[model samples]
Target: MAMALETLSSPIILFFALGLLAALARSEMTVPEAFAKGLAIYLMMAIGLKGGVEMAANPLTGEVIRAFGAGIVLSFALPLVAFAALRLTSGIDRVDAAASAAHYGSISIVTFVAATEVVQATGLMPGGHLVAVAAVMETPAIITALLLARQANAAGGPVAGSERGELLREVMLNASVVVLVGALIVGWIIGPEGFEPTKPFFVAPFQGVLCLFLLDMGLSAGRGLRQGWRQLDVGAITFGLYMPLISAAVAAALCWVLALAPGDSALLITLAASASYIAVPAAMRLALPKAKPAIYLTLSLGVTFPFNLTFGIPLYTAMGQWVGS
Candidate 1:
């Protein structure tokens, strides 16, 4: 309860809430699209660099290898579970369900960033390899979702005008994946001493920058909900709310089996719980054009993102503490 209150009142979250509220109230305020894009790049670069530096400080242990493998397995497997649930519980068609399933299997970078803040505040530093794990986890569910959609008689092959390699390009070279993985490698090469020169720009200002980014995210989410909510049925909306908890439970069990530390476990749980709004949406546009963005995007960005930001983080934190203890 205390953790939840603290998180809700934090400047980062409060700013997000402010944006959400303003948007819901139908205010005219807007963040410049280009500038918001820049903010996203900056945040991703900062965290990628930080994670790389930490990873450089330590050799990759067997446990780290196991965590990486676990993450991949989860990424590939979760969509199957999500697809089944969505098909059974919601009125959405196979393509939409498959598209939505891909999102559930994927991780949200912004949510991971937010969870990192909470983890850091609690003085439990998560491993850098998790960033690598996050990078690895980005695309497999995409493949799975495509397969599921095909199997269910949803459109097969590329959408008209999509090149043979377009889906590959979308998955591999997407802004978040490229910037994150590239920055991580750069940071790994630079090491701590080399990163020191950029500390003022990258490290000290990170939290404030994050606050600004979250505010924009909140606005995006709120606006998406306002415009797209009608596309989501009650069951679909409920799935968005509950699926994260389901994923978190699955991750918690894996964390316990793998014997991860509380900090690491919490991060993994959060990643598993988060739904992809950015990466999956782009892929869906190219691959499953028939799939309604209004359904998947609103559910992910509006319902799931806010829930994870507000309540899921605290619950996952407690789960981590319990499992680690």
Candidate 2:
């Protein structure tokens, strides 16, 4: 209860609330698209570097390997479960179900970032290798989704104007993956001493920048919900709300089996709980061109994202604490 109150009361969440309220109220305020994109890049780089540095300090261990394996397994497996649930419970067709399932299988970096803050506030330091786990988890869900769609006879040929390696390139070389992996490598090489000079820029200003970025995110989410909520039926909306908990439960069970620390377990649970609005959406546009971006994007960005931000983090953190203890 105290943790929930603290999370809700934090400046970051409050700022997010402000943006959400402002947008829903139809306030004319806006964050410029280019600037917001820049903020996104900076946030990714910051988190990646921090994670890398932490990895540098810690020795390579079997536990880290297990965590990475767990992430990959979850990424590959969750979409199958999600696809089944969506097909059974919702009216979405196979292609759309697969696309949406891909999202649930992928990690949301922003949500991971937010969870890091909350986890650290609880004084549990998450493992640095989890950043690598996150990067590894991004693409397998897309493969599983494509496979699911193909098995359902929903597979289509290459999208027009798409090169042979295009989807692969998008999956492997997207900005988020590139910057995140590159920064992680750089941080691992530099370690703490070499990273000191840049602390003022990357470390000190992080929370404030995150506040600004999340405010913009809140606005994006609100505007998306306002515009797209009509497309979603009650079951679809209900799926968006419940699916994260389902995924979190799966992750928590895995965490227990793996015996991860509370902080790392919470992060893994949150990652599993988060849906992708960035990487998977782009991949879906290309891979499942027939899939309705409106449904997937709206649910991921509007419903699941906000739910994870506002309540899900605290819940996952508490769960991690319980399982770890």
Q: All predictions: root-mean-square deviation over Cα?
A: 1.0, 1.0
> For candidate 1, lDDT tens digit of each residue in 1-325?
9889999999989999999999999988899999999999999999899889989998999778878887888899999989999989989999999999999999999889888888878888789888988888899989999999999578675556767888899999999999999999998999999999999999999999999999999899989999999999899999999999999999999989998888888988999999999999999889888999999999899999999999999899888877863
Worst 10 residues of 2 by lDDT: 152-161
Where is model 2 more than 4 Å wrong at Cα? none
For model 1, the local distance difference test gives 0.91
lDDT of 1 at 86: 91
Identify the runs in model 1 with alpha carbons over 4 angstroms from their true place: none
Q: What is the lDDT of residue 126 in candidate 2?
A: 86
Best by lDDT: 2
How far off is residue 63 in model 1, in Å?
Answer: 1.4
State in Å the error of residue 71, model 2.
0.4
lDDT of 2 by residue, 1-325 (tens): 8988999999888988888888899988999999999999999999889889989989999889989999999999999989998898989999999999999999899999999999999998889998999999999999999999999679777667878888899999999999999999999999988889999999999999999999999898888888888878888889899999999999999999999888889999999999999999999988999999889998899999999998999999998887763
Quantify all predictions' global Cα lDDT against the true fold: 0.91, 0.92
